[model samples]
Target: MKEIDKIALIEIKNRQILHVRSKGKLKFYLPGGKREASETDEQTLTRELHEELSININTNTIKYLGTFKAPADGKADGVLVKITCYTAEYTGNLKPANEIEELRWLNNSNLDIISEASKKIFEFLKQKGEID
Candidate 1:
């Protein structure tokens, strides 16, 4: 089985989680990306948020949420995406940058529009009463 490791940020506001769609992607995903060579999770999160959302993640406030894995969306069967999630404070307004085409705050009702790994995260946050 192939696993794609990623680091993601869980930014919630008023019970809605931030989701982003890449320029050519259909499913909205949590803000983050794959780690660069030898980069730590915090480093990846900080860099990706800045690159994708035009915001800086406050590394000091970073907290581990959970890790989720599911069949990679739009990839072949048996290819899984392993997302390591974190919640952190950020600076600056969120705007789509780099490869991001759009940003949206999503709730449980929008499940069908997100990736499978994101679905796992939404379910986790919902169970914890973090998102509606």
Candidate 2:
């Protein structure tokens, strides 16, 4: 099995979680990406969000959520993705940048357009009553 490690920021509001659609992609994903060499999870989150969503993460507010794993979307069935999630305070308007084509606020009902790992996240949030 292949394991793809990544970090994600979970920003939910009004029953929706912030997501993004990258250029040339059909699914939406949480606002984060793979960690670079020798980078901490916090540093990865800080850089990815800024590059993709133009936001400044408030390092002081960073809180670890949980890690989720599922079949990697669009990859072979044996390929898996592990997403380490966090919640943090941020500033600046959310905008698509780099490869991101658009921003979306998604709920469980929108699972069809999300990655498998993201589906797990939706179910988790629903169980916690964080998203409807």
Candidate 3:
């Protein structure tokens, strides 16, 4: 089985999650990306957030959320994506940047529009009563 590893930011407020759409993509995803060689998880996530949303994440304030895995979106069958999530304080205006074309604060009703890995994140958050 093929596995795609990624790191993600889990920023939730008012029972909603921050989701982003990459340019030309059909699905919304949590703000993050795969780690580059030699990058720690925190470094990877922090760099991804800044590149995608122009937000500087406070490395010292980062908290490890849990890791979740699901079928990799847009990949061949039997491929899975493992996403390690973290919540952290950030500084900057949350605007679409780099490959990101749009951003939304999504609730459970919009789950179908997100990637499979993101669906699992929402499920975990919903079970914790983080979103309706």
Candidate 4:
């Protein structure tokens, strides 16, 4: 089995979470991407933020939010994705960049439109009373 390691930023505001739609996908995902070779978690997150949302993450403000795993979406059955998530402060206006198609804020009711991995995060947040 192949495992994909990724990082996700769980930016929450007013009980809503930020999500981005990929250019050729139906599901929305947390604004993040895979880690680069020799990059630290913070470095990977900073680069992904700049590339995907045109923002800069304040590394000092990053809070680890645990990790999650799920079968890799749209991939073979034995493939899995391991996601390390963090909540952080950021600078710069967010805009759809690179391969991003749209950016949206999602609450509990928007679960069906997001990817399976994100749904797990949504459930976790809801259980923690972070979102209603």
Q: Between 3 and 4, whose lDDT is larger?
A: 3
The reply for model 1, stretches above 4 Å from the true place, is none
For every model shown, the clashing-pair count is 0, 0, 0, 0
Query: lDDT by residue for model 1 over 1-132, one digit each (tens)?
Result: 999999999989999999999998999999999999999999999999999999988889999999999999999999999999999998999999999999999999998899999999999999999988
TM-scores, one per candidate: 0.98, 0.98, 0.97, 0.96
Per-residue lDDT, model 2, residue 68, is 99
User: What value does the lDDT take at residue 125 in candidate 4?
Assistant: 93
Where model 2 places Cα greater than 4 Å from the true spot, the runs are none
Model 3: CA > 4 A from native: none
lDDT of 3 by residue, 29-87 (tens): 99999999999999999999999999999999999999999999889999999999999
Give the candidates in order of TM-score, highest first.
Answer: 1, 2, 3, 4
Q: Cα lDDT for residue 119, model 1?
A: 94
Clashing pairs in 1: none
lDDT at 102, model 4: 99
Name the lDDT value of residue 122 in candidate 4.
91
Better of 2 and 4 by TM-score: 2
Per-candidate Cα RMSD to the true structure, in Å, reads 0.6, 0.7, 0.7, 0.9
Spell out the clash pairs found in candidate 4. Answer: none
lDDT of 4: 0.92
lDDT of 2 by residue, 101-128 (tens): 9999988889899998999999999899
